[model samples]
Target: MSGSWRAGLLAEGVSITVTAKAYRLLRAILMTATEDDKMLSRNPCWIKGADNERTPERPILTLAQVFELADRMADRRFKAMILLTTFASLRWGEVIALRRKDLDLTARTVRVREQLLELEGGEMRLCPPKSRAGKRTISIPSAIIPALADHLKRFVDEAEDSFVFLGKRGAFLRGGNFRREAKWAEALKEMGLTGLHFHDLRHTGNTLAAQSGASLADLKARMGHDSDRAALIYQHATRDADQKIADALSARVKAERKKARKKDH
Candidate 1:
């Protein structure tokens, strides 16, 4: 069945993503039938690499490009959002779910406890992180502290439970609405970053963290990955080491800003 489906999909010119998802669906259904129902002695939906989707490598912004993208946002509120997501390695769900209490500017930390999940009918619900490792305390660079402080003063409510970021109507941020209102596409295009995704900001942060000499365990803890395949060295990762990574990020930003100033002069 798997072999025929693969051949049929290829012959029909189905996209790789659709073919892989279809293969995954078939594999999952067969696995359930074999293991739970015991209707089949073995699952035959086995095709090597058929379920894997080979997506293109996402673009990573340089430190200077990150700042440029953030500055290009017409809404000042989104400036901090872009920087925080890039520097702190926050997922979209986690960033949108952030409450005033989640950030500690004095301590330079951001805590992730929950995510704002969008349901099928456009309903939004606050739920815990996808995995245990996702609920983590991340050290943020001091360079973005001023932007965050400014955003909170102007945009966020004083109540601790109030969301850190909000829509124009003082409600939870919706992804589509945010993109349209914040001029996300315009900002990207103006910065020559067409097709760059918001999630790529987190990828840039993770890459920077690694380049800062963060160990494998440090990456695991920072990224919130729990599967054995994705996790290692968590026990050895220390808060101090994470702080060093944050400091390195801050230094990089400072250096980049100085270079920009020099060029302007």
Candidate 2:
């Protein structure tokens, strides 16, 4: 069955990561059913290290690059959105679902209560976030407060219940529509950044937080991740911070050796 699945995926040009996930899910379900049915003392669907396969790493943007992209955006309204997602570590749905009341400018915090999901037929529905942890309050940076304030004052509706972000026709913002209408491709070209997805902004924020010495618990809370595994990925993804630590250790060892040599002389 595994060989057949692999052949099918290859024929369809599906990613190996996707194949692994599909097989993992199927294996779990089959093993559980077999165990429950007393078919065997121990159900055997285990393929060593198959469940531990890693996907391709996501691209993370620098703080300067994030700001530059925001600045180059054609729509003034989306500029704040870019900053909020990268700095506040908000998912696309969480950011777009924001209402006027969800934002507390005085406190500089955004309450993530819900998310807006767009169905296949362009229908939008308000739903709870992906996980319980996703329903969190994130504090905004002082630097971005002004941008959010300006956005609210200029573009947002007056009613507290009104959506913070809306389409030109006063409808809920759809991801596809926003990408095309906002000239996302053109903006990326100008920034010389290719293959950067919108969700990568959240990854950038989580990685930056990890690099800043935020503990795993802090990262989990800030990113609204339910598992420590997700938080650990951010720490592992911070290559620059890891290199700095290595450099510091080398410098300290060199300094100690120099001091010992001087004393011996």
Per-candidate Cα lDDT values, in order, are 0.82, 0.82
lDDT of 2 at 167: 77
- Would you estimate the TM-scores of all the predictions? 0.70, 0.75
Error of 2 at 83 (Å): 0.5
The 10-residue segment of model 1 with minimum total lDDT is 229-238
Instruction: Note the clash tally of each candidate.
Output: 0, 0
Model 2, 40-107: lDDT tens digits are 56645565555545656667898899999888878878899999989999888888899999999899
Off by over 4 Å in 1: 1-52, 228-265
Error of 2 at 144 (Å): 0.2
Q: For candidate 2, report its TM-score.
A: 0.75
- Give per-residue CA lDDT, model 1, range 1-265, as digits (tens): 7798686554333446788998999889999999999999999987889888884466778999998988888788899999998898888889999999999999999999999977867799999998999999999999899999999999888999999888888878876677877898788878877657777888788777776777777777888877644333222333555778999999999999999999999
